[model samples]
Target: MTGSVTVAGLGPGDAALVTPEVTQALSRATDVLGYVPYVARITPRDGLRLHPSDNREELARATHALEIAAAGGHAVIVSSGDPGVFAMASALFEALETWPGDRHPEIAILPGITAMLAAAARAGAPLGHDFCAINLSDNLKPFALVENRLRMAARGDFAMAFYNPRSKSRPHQFARVLDILREECGGDRLILFARAVTTPDEAIAVTTLAEATPEMADMRTVVLVGNSATRRVGRWVYTPRSAESAAG
Candidate 1:
């Protein structure tokens, strides 16, 4: 009665955005685990056990999920947005590093729409051109490393999507990020602050680096910085598919 583990994405607060594969896995799961709010998204049923933990307990959660699977119980770990994008999939693989090879449970990662894609769509194709996604949380990495990546991405003129931009504890860091972007991408650059995309509380703000403020983003926000070419067409914001300075 060997069991298995499924890492499934719930897709950014919208029930309709969840993929069929993830839905199927959740339907068959004997136990579901995730961060507190993500686990709350699951409807409790008679046979399904829900395990919710704090956001900082990703490794512990992954280990627990694996342990349940190895014990012959079907386990599923849920993540908001795609699990592989700065989410549970990486943490699960990291936990597997110490897992005994002979007893490793079957694992599957099912994809879902990530925040950037959802945000981009709502903002009218701001990510239609070359782009990069960066998680701004300094929980697992150094602030200096985050700054360096930000500088490089701006220097490359890549449209950028940012996740976990601000939280209560590290409120000041996002201000520094805005400063860095202003330095590297210039003050006139276009920026979009998309908060709680597709949910009932959704709000989208389009502005420029000069006008962008740190308070515009909270943990639920996904920020987008367009390359020099990004602009408005009527009420829509978009970066064209071709580079601004490209040769014929």
Candidate 2:
């Protein structure tokens, strides 16, 4: 009995946001694996075995899921938001690269709404134009790399969405990020912080680079920095669709 590994996204915090495809995948899974909170979202069942682990154990978890699949068990790996967006999908492939076994298990990836899209929707169409998403965690990469990306994005005038902007361990990095943004985008550039989005504790705040501070964001927050053309209409923040209108 050949088995398979399914990587599914549970969406953001809301159960309503979870796609039916991902839900169906979970229902059919023989074993489920993911970070603790994401795995906790899965309901306990008679035949389904849940493997919850720490966030940093992604590669090991991916390997374990593949191992289960190799043994003819249907393994599902869950990620909050989209699995491909700075989540388990990449790690799964990385684990697969070093697999010693010749018979590789079947693999599938299911997409879901990421925090950037969810946050952007709640705060209005700040990403209506060209945009890019950057992970600021610096866990697997250098802070200098993150800084360079920020600078390049600003210089390119791209609307930017940032993930893992701030955490307790590196509280001050976001401050430097804001300083750099101020220098590149200037004082009037709009920046929005959407925290705990799609949950009961959700909060969204929009401000300018001059007034924005590091304390406005956290690990759960997705930050949006708009281009010069971004502005507010009524209460919604949006960037113009036309470059000529944006320039004018």
Candidate 3:
């Protein structure tokens, strides 16, 4: 009896963003495990157990979630944003490989609306062209890799969406990203700040790269750095092709 774990992105909340498929899976789930805030979104039902864990206890939380599913029941792991984007799916795989269990359960990854996409939508398609997401947190991966990716993205002329830009402990990470961008793409590059999208107190701000500040962003803000080809029209920001620009 192989039970499977289904990962669902609950979107920003219980509003229109919740997909029919996610709702169906939630209805059928024997247990739902996630970081505390994500699991708090849904109402609990009979046989629908909720396992909320500390956010930093990622690997352990995933291992426990899988164990629950392998015990002859259904399980779903909830990630607030897209699981693959920067969420639980990879950690789950990593934990499995770190301590491979004899009883392997079926696992499946489902997509959810990522903060960057939702942020882009609110800011009028800043990610219309090439873009990349880099986590500025150097605790896991070295900052050198982060800097390398930032430089590469800048040189490649790609719009950038930076995740985990800053936290309490690591406060100066985004400054380095900004400096790199300024040197590579000039200070005139437009930037969109989407902080805590879909939440009641969400904020959206647009500014130039020269004016971007570390205090303007935190772990929750999805930083958007427009490519050289990117532009702003009225309330929207987008990357337009030279051919399209000429045609217009």
153-203 per-residue lDDT for model 2 (tens digits): 888889999999999999999999999999988999999999989999999
RMSD of 3: 2.8
**Residue pairs of candidate 3 with colliding backbone atoms:** none
- Candidate 1 has its poorest 10 consecutive residues by lDDT at 239-248
List TM-score per model, in order. Answer: 0.97, 0.97, 0.93
Whichever of 1 and 3 has more TM-score, that candidate is 1
Candidate 1 per-residue lDDT over residues 126-162, each given as its tens digit: 9988889999999989999999999988878889999
What RMSD, rounded to one decimal, does every model reach?
A: 1.7, 1.5, 2.8
Give lDDT: candidate 2, residue 10: 89
Q: Find the number of clashing residue pairs for candidate 3.
A: 0
Error of 3 at 108 (Å): 1.4
Residue 53 error, candidate 2, Å: 0.4
Instruction: Let me know the TM-score candidate 3 reaches against the reference structure.
Output: 0.93
Cα RMSD, model 1: 1.7
Off by over 4 Å in 3: 241-248
Cα lDDT, model 2, residue 188: 98
